[model samples]
Target: MATEVSSRLFYHFLGALKRTHSFSNFSFPLGLPQTSMSYSASKTWISPQTKELETWTKIRDSIMRISPRSPFIPKTFADWLEHRLAIKEDQLRKVVRKIARISGRDDRQETTIHPVLGVKEIEDRRALVLARETIWRQSLESFPGRRLAPWPSYEEYKHEGDDRSKSGYRRFLPLPRDPGNVTVNWKQRKPLPQYLFDEVGRRTTVDNEEDKEPGLDELLAMEFVGASLILLLDS
Candidate 1:
C-alpha cells in the first residue's frame, strides 16, 4: 500500500516539475504603449509586471533549492507538495499586499465584501491549513476502508475490559488490533543506590571532599623555593 502511494506521489511530483519547467519558456506581454496610456493606468499595468518579475525570481530560487542534483531533496512527495504550497501561499500574500495597497485598505482585515477577491493574511493562513489537511487526508485515503481511530481517554481505556488484573489497563493497546502485541515486564533486578537521591549541592560537597588536596609539606617546599629565588636575585 505504501509503495503504491509512493509511486503515485512520484508521478504527481514529476508532472508538477514539468509544468514548472514549461513556465520558464512562457513570457508575459510587458511591452505596452507608454504614450497611449495615462500615468495611473501605466502604473497599474507596471505593478503586475513587477509582481510577475518577483514571482519568477521566487520560482528561480525554488528551482535552485530543489534541483535534481541537490542532496537535500524532500524525503516524501507530501513534503515536496507542502514546499510548493508554501511558495504558492507566499505568492498569494504578495498579491494580497498589492491589492491592499491599491485599494487603500488595512491588511489586518480578516475578511472583505468579496469572498474570492478579498484575501487577507488570516484567510491565507486558514487556506494553508485546509490545504495541509486535504493533503494528509488524500494520503490516508490510499488505505482503502481503513479510517484512523480516535485516541481513547484514560478513564475509558482503564475500564475497557472486564478483567482488571489480566485485561483492561494492564493489557492496554494503543494501536489497532491488527498485528500481535507483545507485553514485557520491565522490572528492575537490583535496588537503586541511596546516594542517587542526594541533593546536588550535597553531592558537589562530597565530590570536593573526595578530591585530593595539596599537602602542607608541598606548600612549605614551594615557599622555601620562593625564598631561595629571592636571595639569588638580591645577590
Candidate 2:
C-alpha cells in the first residue's frame, strides 16, 4: 500500500513540476495583428509558483468546506488527485517539522486539543466509515487475492547500528557542519492548512471495533469516497 501510494504521488508531483515549468515559459506573442492598448493593459505577470500556490489554496479550501452529508464525493480521477495533493501537503509539513527537530533547529512544543464531535458529526462519520469498509473489503477480495505479509515486530528487527540514547535510529548521524550555506529557504514553503490538519486528526481518532482507521497514505491507497472526505474522517 505504501509503495502504491508513493508511486501515485510521485507521478502527480512530476506532472505538477512539468506544468510549472511549461507555465514559466509562457508569454504573449511578440507581434499582434491589432495595435490595441487593451493587450498591454491586460498584461499581468504572476510567477508560476505563485499561481500554483493560489490554485492549491483554492482547492484545499473547497475540499475542506465540503459537508459529509453532501452527495458530492471524490469519485472522479481529478477529485482524487486533489485529495491526494492535500494529504501530501500535510505529510510534507510533518516531515519538515521532524527534520527541523532532528537538526536542533526547532524547539517549540505545541499541543492540539480537538473539539468533541456533535450528534450529526458522529452520524456523518459512521456513514463514511461504512463506505470506507465496503471499499476496503472489495479491494481485499479483488483478483489475485493474496494476503500481505505482516510487519516485522520490534524485537525481530535489527537495532545494532542504532544509538539507544537517541529517540531515532539515525539521530547519531551528524548534520552538515556549515548549516548557514543551505540553498533551500524552508520558511518560504507554504504550510498545510490548519483546518485540514484538524479534520485529519479528528477523523483518524474515530474508533471502530472491527477495523481501526488507517494512516493518511493507506486511506489514499483505499481511495475512500466523499468530498474532502479524504481528510475529514480519521483512520
Candidate 3:
C-alpha cells in the first residue's frame, strides 16, 4: 500500500518536475540529461523508496536553480543564505587577519579583507550549499546506498603500489572528497592559507565585546524565515 502511494508521487514528480528541475532536459542545451540525474537504477521497475527519492530529488533540484540575483528568488532561502554568508564573511576576515599577522607583514588595510573576494566566496558557497542541503535532506530522508547506488569499492580502481595482502579489502573502500572542501582556482592563482584548515586546540577565539555585530532584527528575520522551512520542504 505504501509502495502504491510512493509510486504515484514519483510519477507526478516526473511530470511536475520536467519544467523546473536543474537537471531537466531543458537545463542541458545538448538535450542530454545529467549523468547522475536519471531515476532508473536497476531494472525497468523502481521500488517504493526510489519513487520517494525521485519525488524529493525533483523538488530539491527545482529549488537549487533559483538565483538570488533573479528578481523572483523565494524570500526564505535568500534570507537564510544571506545571513549565513554574513557570518562566514566575518569568519573569513578573522582568518585573513591571522594569515597577514603570521606572514611578518604589517597588517595593511587592503589585505585585512578583500571585499570582492568575500562577496564571491559567499555567493559561490551559498549556491553550492543550497543545492547540497536540498539533496542531502532528500536522500537522507529516503535512505542512502540502496536502490540507487553505493560508494564504489577499492576493487573499482587499480593502483600500482597497493598490496592486496596487507592492504586487504580496505584499499577498495571509497575515499570520497567532501563537497564543501575549499576549491582552489588555478586560473586566478588564489590560495587560501593553510591555517584555515588547521586545528585550534580547545581555545575558542571570541570577538571583542565592543565589536559591532549585525542587529538582532537581521538574525530575527533569518530565524523567522527558518520557522517556515516546512513550506520550503514541501514547495
Candidate 4:
C-alpha cells in the first residue's frame, strides 16, 4: 500500500524539475523550461513552482515522520495511490450523502441528474433491502440435496442392514433398489468447481513466488471473498 507522504514527494519532485532551471548548458527530455537565471536576484522569495514544491516537501516530511514504511519507490506506489484516492473519495461521498439524508438536509434537487435514471434514493434503498432479503431466503431454502453434513453417526456409504428410511437419497431415488444412489457420497461444504479450484490453486500457490508463497492478486482475491459470491458445488 502507498502512503500519503510518498505520493506528495513524487509530485513535489515533478514541480521541482519544472523550477530552478539553468539557461547555461540546459537540456530536458521531459519538456522542462530553460530559464535565463536559476534563482531570481531581485526577490528573496522563490518562484511559484519552487514554492509549491517546497510546501509539498514540508508536508511529505511531516507525513513520513508518522508513517512506518521506508525506502519508498515513487513509480509503483504513487500511481497506485492516485487510484486508491479515487476509490476512497467515492466512498467518502457516499458517507456524506448518507449523513445528509439522515439529518434531513440532503441536496437531492440541486445536484447533477442522470438523463435516463428512473429510481429515487428512498426507493433505491428499499429495493436494495428487499432484494438482499429475497436472496438470503432463496439461499437458505435452496439446499443441495446431496450435501449431507459429515456427522459421526451418518455413513458416507451404505452398510449391510443400514436403514434407508431416513436417508434423503433413498426418498428421492428414481427406482427401487438403486445401488447407484446407495453408493454415492455426500459432503457438507460446497466444494470449489474444477476450474475455479484449479485457477485459485495455480494463481495462489503453484504460480506464485516459491519463497514468498503468494503474491498480491492471489492474496487480495482470497482475503476479499465475501460469502455471497460462493455457491453450492460438488467436491
lDDT of 1 by residue, 1-235 (tens): 6545644554454444323433333445545432335655633333323333444555555767778466565544455545555565565677679888988976688874675435633322222432322212213331333343334435435544434545434654433222212231112112222221121343233356547554444444556668677567759
lDDT of 2 by residue, 1-235 (tens): 6545744674566454423233443333423243335665865665433444444455445666875345565543455556656766766677789888899854486666765433334321222443332222323332133223233323223332343435454433221121222353333323322222234335545577457655555655556475456457754
Task: Choose 1 or 2, whichever is better by lDDT.
Answer: 2
TM-score of each: 0.18, 0.18, 0.16, 0.17
| Model 1 misplaced regions, further than 4 Å | 1-71, 105-235
lDDT of 2: 0.44
Q: How many backbone clashes does candidate 1 have?
A: 0
Q: Tell me the deviation in Å of residue 213 in model 1.
A: 93
**Alpha-carbon deviation at 95 in model 1, angstroms:** 0.4
Model 4 per-residue lDDT tens digits across residues 162-222: 4454553343221112123333544332332321222433543454465656454555455
Candidate 4, superposed: residue stretches over 4 Å from native: 1-75, 105-235
Per-residue lDDT value at 64 in model 1 = 71
Evaluated at residue 185, the lDDT of candidate 2 is 39
lDDT of each: 0.44, 0.44, 0.40, 0.41
- How many residue pairs clash per model? 0, 5, 1, 0
